[model samples]
Target chain A: MTYLNKIKIFVLVFMFILFTSSINAQWNIPADAKNKKPPIDPTHTLVKTGKDLYKSNCASCHGTPGQGNNIAAIGATDLGTADYQHSHSSGQTFFQVEQGNGGMPSFREKFSSDEKWCLIFYIKSFDKDFEISGEELKEQKADLRLSLVEKIRTVKAYATTKDKSGKEIPLEGAEVQFFIKRMFGNMQIGELVPTDNKGMASIKIPENIPGDEEGKLNLLVKFKDTDTYGKVIKSKTIKWGSKLKIVNITDKREMWGSLHRVPLWVLFSYFGMTIGVWLVIGYVVFQIIRLKKL
Target chain B: MSEVNKEGTKKTIGTIVSDLTRPIKNHKGFTIWILFLLTVMGVGMMAYVDQLANGLGVTAMRDYISWGLYISSFIFFIATALVGMLISAVLGLIGIKWITPIARIAEMIALGFAMWAGLIIIFDMGRPDRALNLFIHGRLQSPILWDVTVVTTYIAISVLLYLLPLIPDMPFLKKAMTDQAKWKQKIYKILSFGFEGRPEQYKSIKKLIRILAILIIPVALAIHTVTSWLFAMTPRIGWDSTIFGPYYVTGAFVAGGAAVMIAMFVLSRNYNLKDYITDFHFDKMGKLLVLLMLVYFYFNINEYIVPGYKMKAGDDHHILGLFTGHYAKMFWTVQLGGMIIPIILLLFRRMRKPLPSLFIGIAVIIGAFFKRYIITIPTLVHPHLPIQNVPEEFHSYWPNAWEWAITMMAIAGAVLIITILAKLFPIMPIWEVAHEEGITNEEMNKYVKES
Candidate 1:
């Protein structure tokens, strides 16, 4: 080949290497051992049962083999991988399956108890086991089962007003405030909760409200009357407990008027002055021009 | 001077008023009807003022039909003003002495209506207060700026053309006055600029008029060309065309000729000017109108036919709309009544007579207004994208009462300006008339006898 032909070949090869190297760099994965996981075989019966249960219910989102590769699982974790399973507990998975996570519909009423267990088993099969102590298992079981102390940290309120059908109306825009028991305990922990547009308010107990051993918190929740000045129309109290959850506090008196106002005099005066000044200036100019012409 | 001979000399205001009222007293029916029409038009103007105060929403024009009757009237005014340049400037340069008698009238009409066009454009703007922005932020690239520049130039030149020859006539007017008010005397003195009709002043005035007459022709063409570019520059399907500039100039001449004919008919009959503006002038104007109409028709064919034949995808909706769709009636009426009918009417010798030609002129003027409306509105209705997310009212345009009232006010305002100008200055060019009679005694006597 001629020297010119060799130069042309070298340039073509250089361009091909540059393009392929850029494409490879974009698709490169980290070589960390922690990030890598052995794939699970679907032929295992336990895995197969989990896959069947998931397909019948969760596969629409979690995908076959719990890969979380389904269309609905976009922006969600890939469940078939071991890395994701290690971070979550069996109890947390069961709760998520029963209550549903963001964008995932709840299977609480849809699946039987055995089917949920099978789904959980399939999810677990993706991870290699780590040690679990007796104390940790007891703590996990205790947290899974909702007790009175565990339930105390949550509260739910509903709107009492309704149409002619007498069904509870969704109350939105109601303000809910919580106050501590001690004297001069006026410091507010959180901002006021304006009820949702549907007129429902939910308040969760703060975790720092010292455990039961630290002198019981005398908690008081009052529905603030928006129309009246400094008025507390409705009040509720929860005695010494780890936390308190009040559900459905629906009273007609709990509904309050809005706290929005616009002063009329200020609006009118501002506009009036602007228009008056313009008219006077215009008139004066016209007179001056007329006089000059005359 | 020369015993102020009433028959062959200037008449006093009292004598002129007596002479003018004598015909009115004898013809009460015609006088009363004219008075009644003037009253109605005045009332319409009062209603229009109410519209200006309230806003354009008083009219049927929604956003879709933004430039409605107001825009049409503006186009009509600009088109009419073209006649002044065509007659005074173009014919004067060519040395057509026959057009001299009516040159002042054409110039006055052009001056009055061109000024009115500027006012009407401001009135059409949603934010009339922002009209000064057209100058302040004016982009040379914009056709609107070009329009503003050319129109301002045209108006200035037209006013100068209308005023220049009046220098010699001003002394005649000043001396002829019997009960002239103080302000009127002052105005006449100032306007006359101490014109003594000296040889130098006369020569200077003639030179000035000649310069202006030469300058006004291209400015006249530019004004209409820029006005057409306001639409043609847009991306709208019907409006984007290379032929629009010359097409618009031809239409301007057609409309301008019609306007001149109408003005001549009205002023001659009302002012008893039959001797000055005779059947011969009408015959000449009729022939000019025919020529202009033919030229305009040829441009119209180029404007509408080729794109219409190709039926380009973008233009299909707009073309179909004009051809046999929603705008068919207006398109046919304007094309036929404005161009074809006037051409045919003016073609016949008998129809070129004053009465028939006057009717044709009126038809042409009204048709031209609708032609402008068709030009502006249909293209807006069919923009590049499909109309969406807007109220149903935005899809179509019809001028509301306010638009109609304001449009009428603009027309009345133009007429009012012409009337006021005619009152101040002689509608006929007095100096030109006297010059045509001759500068020497024996020649003047022969001219008197010949007439």
Candidate 2:
């Protein structure tokens, strides 16, 4: 038993080593140079170009100063913040712009090299202090005023169970759940709130949330066990204007009953039995005829 | 009288020619009708050309059921072909006398179906023109390559097995032809290979067959095992199981047995081979089917119940689908109607009668075809990633008209080959049967002396 156990352990270790080595061999990046970079001048021509590009292209969605807004650009990122810019590299941004990052479309075919440089320049302009000085401050302010919307303060929820006759039905103590997904990270944040007597609940956004400058947030409201429990009742993303409401979460659930609900094993068994029976039947018939003829 | 005896000796060729042609003269009408039906099936195959020109989109197969009937039918052909190896080599090695008569027929069926299997695979390919890439740039590590290798080897062995025995018969056929058509004479002359029925030629034939029989066992196992590996190697929940190799082989034998039975029934009824193929043969085959069915059932239980017990998140969809989900109807019908019912029916003594067994055999073949479909499609539908972005029609697959027509054409083609062969050659081994029944000259002399 001891020897058998040793052999089993040996095999396990061997397999682990084999797998790790194969993975290591496949990754071609050098380890040491992952974190070296040159300092940036916030007011360079590159920076002005970047700013101009941002106003024309990105401001409509990401908003002025990268404070994300614009209904169509609800999922766009904020580039105004210093910490976020310093944490990511120009190469990373270039790659994302070139190849497309998630929902973003590729700009390689649409933009020229100088245009890409201009976009990068505009992105850097989000920084407050810079060495290069030729840009007019008035134009920048005008762009900002035209694009910027008030930041989201808080989200409030209201619910009621009544027909269009305006008669109110009690909906207190019903569990309400809120879900938020970040646009860039696609991370999900959720909280469950019990409805008050008026069938209303509000959630306050915590100050100093990580990556708040990016401002890409999608919110959803769902009720627990209201015949549409475990289903998304109401959902909306907040990007530009602050006020967002989730209504009729229950109606949507009835309209779309769980589209993604198939279990994996059921499909497997389906194939299994189908193939299994066909083979079994064919065998029996062939045998009988074969025997009779013999 | 001596002069008359000389004339008789000289007229031996003429007499044999008349005897051989007699059957064709009598059955020409039936032969013409069967050929006409076969030609219609050939016309159906032209529709498949339209599919090839259009694309697989021509088929009803949606993304969900991407591998519909063609794949299943391919599996059926592969499984049924297993008998060629099993009976011809496996039983032959074991010195089973009763199997010898049918061994050649089994081999021929194997070869015919194996060839059709290749053809159907080409038909199934999204890029049929790229099929040569399978060979030119074939990767040995891939199970598909292994399948290709083994199937080709099996075909070669099957042809050798069929042809070697025909050598002796070929010379006899050559001399027996009185008014042979040009093509027939040419074919006979080429195939005869100047065989004179000498002892040396007999010894060489026997020796080669023995060698081939020994070699064919591993090749046969490799063919089905490699086929199973095609699925098993995939990461799909149903196909990734290790039990697939033996599971596939068992299924292959089961299907192969059914194919052989079906062939026997058709040939016996058509050729009036009552003397050679009898009820006793059916009884024996019924017993074999029972054994195969039981073994398959054991594997089936293991395949389903073990996974069903675990019901892991990955396996959840597939298992539920078979149990009470969308595919539940097909699952239950194939398992119960195709396998369990046939097994139970064959278990009783009365049901083992030739006619009843024939009915059961046909059921097994039909059921096995659907079983192959179940094996392929559902697993594909339930991939690791969620289904998205594809068109709604991509979610399910049913055979389109072109696919159906083409697939039917393949089946028709196999039957056509069998039909043509039966017309030309004796379905039963005349020499072997003569020897077995003690009707040979030596056997007659022994009987006379004893009397």
Candidate 3:
């Protein structure tokens, strides 16, 4: 009995140890990724843009950064705390944001490197000792237009501004994003591209995308740095890509189908068997009626 | 039909008709028994009224335990009603001579319970008015639709099977029962179907009953199998099973068999049917019960052991609750008292006697009922999604006062139907008994009572 009790205690303690160790195990970062640095200059406009992105994407689960109000249960760090900010190098924060861990979502596909760095800069601003260190980006309004390269199937976006001579000039060094309109939201179609000296940024729309039954796609292009250029969008509907076979499941016979769409076999068997048996029953009733008349 | 004139020795046909038809007359005990059943039904009616007035909130059912006592009772009724097909069709077709005295008894139970099974499903509905939606909007793809089809078919066939056998027997009631009420004689006349013992009518009637007998087997299996599908269709912890169709069919036999045994015992002891439903009959039924239970117990093992061995996720809690957790007591009681012990005891010759078999029958039947409750209610509580954040009532279920009353009403209602049927007609078939005793149909048609 004593030996049995000892084994029971060992198992209980073992389980307890296993449970506690899984809570917030250290998140490892690649050595090369640890030394990385921001490639973009942080500015007040960049910080505002970062704040808007944070509200839309991260604040729901992670909560607001500096308020120390992130849902701690899901293991979101309190960015306002000195221990958190001081311990995390800029590169470490960058790697963490790009790769993510556990409940955190990786932003590698969702954002450009510059957008991630700017978002990181705004989060680091929660620390009282941190200071801004770059010239602020000035806000401006710009014109945006779209064109499709039919031969190459590439979609191009142009950003421009009027010069003092009232000529259309190139808006250089601004980022543009291309998208395809979908049911839930605009699906990102290509990488973020900076406007060249010609004021043009373009992306090759993949050939494999299945469009509407008529093979039409509603293509959209927008300025990435929304705070600087405002919400300028350009779009066009084009006949492109393969057709999708749209099947309304309710129109087909299925196990979970509607009343009218029962399978041919099920209807045939159900009615056929029922009527056959009822035919015998009908014969019996006829015999009874014959007996009645006699 | 016979005279006890100079000597007391007479053929048994005189006594058979008189003894069988004698129970149809006014008896004080039967009257009081019916009144008692009516009183129970009255209470159930009031409770049902409260349920209708207040929706289903008057019952203890919630989102989790959506099916309470009414559904289980519906299952129980369907289970009991299967006895008719088993005794009359399955055993009878194989030329089992002993079932003759008990076949109509089985049919009466079948018809009574089946009629109530349909009503009980409507009782489960909060809006009994929308019960027609089951047909109006019903799809052929669903198991519920299959259940409706087969059950209605079974009821139709059961009616034909029950009433058609009475055609040749009505001459005795019509001619010998001249002193009966004018309405009853008229009913017997209508039931006669002018069956004047013609050879063609005899040949056709036999062929017709044989046809229905053959038809009812698959329909019976379908009713129970489709009923099982209503549960097995879902991927719940306990109910999702491939073997559930055969398992339920076997278990139905056990419940239905026990029910027949109990009915046989009561009728023999109380209704002066001791000569026909004898101890020998009880012994044969007891042996049949053992066979039915062993098969059911085999399925029970398959149901629990494989799942219990794995103990995966929700099933672990469900199995443990029955094995050693909250449900352990009721679980063990049902297993030991209802099935295992009865199976063991009835194996003995003495235990197969009428009195002992009745006790075992009661235990098996009561156990069968709660087994359905255990099967349905416990599995619902241990659903796939974790139950969190609700009132304590939603945590588990026990049928409230209203649920119990309404359930009792269904049982009483079934009993009331069986009783009214018994009062109107003979519990044992007159034609079947006469045929079994070597009396010709022509002789039965010519039978006249000695005043």
DockQ of candidate 3?
0.45
**Could you give candidate 1's per-residue lDDT for residues A1-294 as a string of tens digits?**
999999999888766655554444332222342343323322344444555677677666556645456553132346767766776665566666676543456788988766666677678766767321222111100000011233666555543444456665554565666555655664343667766775555666676554244335655554554322134333334443354343443421121211112134433443453344335334433432332132
Interface RMSD (Å), each candidate? 18.4, 16.3, 1.5
Q: Write the per-residue lDDT of candidate 2 for residues B1-451, one digit (tens) a residue.
A: 1211212222222233344334443464666868775776777667777777888777887756667778788888888888888887888788777674467668768877888988888888878989999877754445676687677767766776776666555655555553656787687666656555555655565666677677667777878888888899888888989899888888888888887777777766665554345676777778888789889989999999999999999898999988899788988898987799999999988877778888888888787888888888888778898889998877766676787788888887877776666667656554455445444434422332342
Off by over 4 Å in 3: A1-206, A210-214, A218-233, A248-250, B1-12, B448-451
lDDT of 1 by residue, B297-365 (tens): 998888889998999997888889999999999999999988898888788899988899899999998
lDDT of model number 1:
0.67
Off by over 4 Å in 2: A1-294, B1-29, B36-40, B62-64, B175-182, B439-451
On TM-score, the stronger of 1 and 3 is: 3
Which lDDT values do the candidates have, in the order given?
0.67, 0.66, 0.86
**For model 1, what is the alpha-carbon lDDT of residue B182?**
72
Which residue segments of model 1 deviate by more than 4 Å? A1-67, A71-294, B1-53, B179-185, B440-451
Docking category of candidate 3: acceptable
Candidate 3 lDDT by residue in tens digits, B1-451? 1211112333466788888988787485987898899999999999999999999999999988998888988898999999999999999899888888899989989999999999999889999999889999998998898898888999999999998888877877776678889999999998988887777888888888899999999889999999999999989888999999999999899999999999999887788778787787898999999999999999999999999999887889999999999889999999899999999999999999999999999999999999888888888888788889888899889999999999999999988888888888888888778777777766765564333
